[model samples]
Target: MISRKIILTFPQALLDKPIVYKLIKDYNLIFNILQAKITPDEEGIMILEIKGASRDYNAGISYLKNLGIDIRPLDQKIIWNERKCTHCGLCVDICPTQALSFKRPQMKIEFDKRKCIACELCLRICPVKAIEIQQ
Candidate 1:
């Protein structure tokens, strides 16, 4: 099986299409949507975690690409500037996945990339300018 996190932007023409449904019906892929915005004929955007067989994954992505969907890998990450971090732990509190944690003894913030869903909540919650989305 293969899994990937992706951000998809649907053009105005593709906004009405059931793109995610096509992935499931045609490629047998599992697409877990983390976030979405749809504006009828204007545009559609989604953050999704897709899992399926390798061949199916490839085919599903190809289908989206053919439909003019803008797809970006969500593997891009948030960078924590330790030097600027104040160990306030605001990020830890707002992290839905608990990907950010404070170590008790040393009072240091730790980040686990695997547990993060790229929700960007921590970026908003942090008091200092410590969390930055790496482009």
Candidate 2:
């Protein structure tokens, strides 16, 4: 089995389509939606974690690409600037996934990339602009 985190951008024309249903029904892929902002007649963005056989996963990605959906790796979208971080622990409190946490004894902040879901909550709460979302 293979698992990947990806961001999908849907054009306005495709906003009403059941694209995610196709990923499950046609490619037999399992998807977990980490974040989504979709509206009628507007572009939509979704952050998802997909899991399936390697073959199915590839097919699903190709299917999306063929339909002109813009896809990007989740890691490329969310960036944590270590140098700009102040270790104030403000972002740690807002992280829904606990991706950002305060490390004891050292009194420092820790980031676990694997646990992050790209929800963007930390991006809003960070005082020093340590977290950012790349288009």
Each model's lDDT comes to 0.82, 0.84
Please give the lDDT score for candidate 2.
Answer: 0.84
TM-score of 2: 0.59
Clashes of each: 0, 0
Count clashing pairs, candidate 1: 0
Q: For candidate 1, lDDT tens digit of each residue in 14-129? A: 76677789899999999888877553335666789999999999999999999888888876688888999999988887676778998889989998888987766577568788
**For this target, which candidate reaches the highest lDDT against the unseen true structure?**
2
Instruction: Give the top-scoring candidate (TM-score).
Output: 2
TM-scores for the candidates:
0.57, 0.59
Per-residue lDDT for 1-135 in model 2, tens only?
999999798898898899999999999999999877653336677889999999999999999999999888877557889899999998886676789988899989888988887766677578789898866
Model 1 TM-score relative to the real fold: 0.57
Q: Candidate 2 at residue 2, lDDT?
A: 93
Pairs clashing within candidate 1: none
Off by over 4 Å in 2: 39-41, 77-135
